[model samples]
Target chain A: GAGVSQSPRYKVAKRGQDVALRCDPISGHVSLFWYQQALGQGPEFLTYFQNEAQLDKSGLPSDRFFAERPEGSVSTLKIQRTQKEDSAVYLCASSSRDRGTNEQFFGPGTRLTVL
Target chain B: EDKVVQSPLSLVVHEGDTVTLNCSYEVTNFRSLLWYKQEKKAPTFLFMLTSSGIEKKSGRLSSILDKKELFSILNITATQTGDSAVYLCAAFKQGGSEKLVFGKGTKLTVNP
Candidate 1:
């Protein structure tokens, strides 16, 4: 079976440009999560979803970061007015159940760079 | 806020040696502690400990959690070069939609 996957493995955007990253969770996965990982640092949680409902978005740094899973499968993370500080690897993970219980399978991640 | 701290930011050991990595956390609504190994890519889950004083072992790797002391330890016996990677410790909180907070991680290098 296919594992979690993210599109645009590498993205280079102008400082003021906007970018959108996509995530495709494993089939039948009920839980999805997004995280941001800086170089030489651990992943920082950004948002989580259960099916089509957004359960948590507390870790989002600012209003420029927005995420949605409209149909309960694919998810999109949008960042408006990208800044240098926003350059990092955006990771997506999925689990069969809620994250608190099941092991999360991660994707290759999208490396976003603000030039 | 929940915080997970991993000690000895980096370690270097030779093959056939043993190494121990430590993790301590302060989290609200404590739930479970998890360990992960990362190479150049995504992290892969190792063990998840929700009970104290219980050892979870897999091959040459073993981990134990100490809930009373709010700490955990991962031990690797007979270290091999393949074990070289960044070890991340994460704490999961129950409330507020089950948050998982990760540590800065400890890098381990095994020389053959």
Candidate 2:
């Protein structure tokens, strides 16, 4: 079985520029989640989706961060204006059921750097 | 406020030795505690503990939760060099926007 996967393993963007990160969850997974991990730290929850519905977006740092999962399979996280503070690894995960119950399978995170 | 804390930020041990990692959490309305091993990218799940006094084991790795004390312990017996990585502990809240509260993690380095 293929695991969750993210694109553009590494990205570097100038400040004030916009960037988009992609994530492909496992097939048949009903739950998808995004997280941000800074260096020497653990991952912090960013958002969660159940199917095609955006269930939780509380962890999003600011209005610049937005995510969507229209078809219930692939998800994209967009930043309107990149900032140096946004430089971190963005991780995606998926589970067969609600994240409250099932274990999440992680993807190789996409490292984003804002210069 | 620190909701979860893992002690011994970094550890170094030789192969065939045993090691223990600790995690204590103060997550509101806690539901479960989970352990993950991270090397380079993705963090792989190791165990999920929802009940107290029940130990979960897989190969040389084992974990136990103490709900009453609000803590958990991950143990590795006869460790190998492959076991070297960052171990993360997370607390799942029963009902809240913050689903999983994670600790800073313990970086374990094993030498053969």
Candidate 3:
């Protein structure tokens, strides 16, 4: 079975540019999550989607970050006006059940560098 | 704010040695504690503990949770070079929605 997958393993963008990262969750996963990991630090929560509905966005650091999962299986995390501080790994995870029921399977992640 | 703290940010051990990693957390609506192993990329799930006093074991890796202490410990016995990786501890919270709060992670270096 295929695990969660993220596109553009690496991306470099100029400051102020907009970038979009894509994630393809496992075939039947009903829950998806996004997280940001800074250098030498742990991954911080970004947002979560249960199916096509955005359940939580509190973890998003700023208004510049946006995510959507219209179809419920694939998701996109878009960053507007990239900053050097945005340079890090964007991880996507999916789980068969909602939180408290099962563990999440993570994707390889897309490493973004803003210069 | 929710926080998960791991001890000994970094450790180095030789093969055949046993290593224990500690994780303590303080968060609202704590549901479960999880452990992950990261190797240069994404973290893979290791263990998820929801009840206290129960030990979860998988081969040479084992974990025990103490809900009263708000902590958990992961032990790797007879460590091998293959065990070298960053070990991450996370606390799952189920409030309005589900979220996994993480610690800075512990870098483990197992040299043969």
Candidate 4:
């Protein structure tokens, strides 16, 4: 695809169940980012990846939330134990440059609903 | 904590009307300010401003940043119904971990 793409546009999980979301950034993009957006609010930063290195995970809410970009092209976000509060749209973005003036291109987010 | 704030949580305008959206930030390591238009699942990039006072424009949409005042404004002139969406303002923080601190957003409704 010409732009970023995400799998499982919508996912529903029962409490305590685990779920994983996938993201495929634009080919050759050096930087990737993950965000969580709640209803009537803006996207909140969750983590950042510069190639295969997981540089920043400060914004991650809990230890249960984990993300990895093993090969630097595709990434996955895993939630170990789903909760109602974990319900939100997870967004993925990528920029060509690894640093400075990063104008990120976003993918259609995956909306997760925890029941 | 570093954060971005946007005003007028919601707005309604008719076709051919002009609207000005406001955003203010109090953040350290401010690399740049950005604007986005989100209608459904994804947010489309609109502008990214690093230097103060320079205007970035795309068709009817234009934006300007004032670093001194820690604020930015997005102006859309002669709006159309298709322009309706949630306009987001985000500040990209620099340094070891580059991340965007976003505001709650301003929802603009353009009715024809």
The positional error of residue A103 in candidate 1, measured at the CA in angstroms, is 1.6
TM-score of chain A, cand. 3: 0.96
What are the per-residue Cα lDDT tens digits for candidate 4 across B23-96? 99999989899999999989999999999999999999999999999999999999999999999999988888
Residue B26 accuracy (lDDT) in model 3: 94
Evaluated with TM-score, which candidate comes out highest?
4
lDDT by residue for model 1 (A39-76), tens: 98889999999999999999999999999999999999
A63-102 per-residue lDDT for model 3 (tens digits): 9999999999899999999999999999999998864655
- Any runs in candidate 1 off by more than 4 Å, and if so which? none
Q: Regarding lDDT, does 3 or 4 come out ahead?
A: 4
Error of 3 at B68 (Å): 0.5
* Candidate 3 runs further than 4 Å off: none
The residue-by-residue lDDT of candidate 2 on B49-109, one tens digit each, is: 9999999999999999999899999999999999999999998876544357789999999
Off by over 4 Å in 2: B96-98
Top-down DockQ ranking: 4, 3, 2, 1
Q: Is candidate 1 or candidate 3 better by lDDT?
A: 3
How big is the positional error of residue A105 in model 3, measured in Å on the Cα after superposition?
Answer: 0.4
* Weakest 10 consecutive residues of candidate 2 chain A by summed lDDT: A95-104
Candidate 2 vs candidate 3, lDDT winner: 3
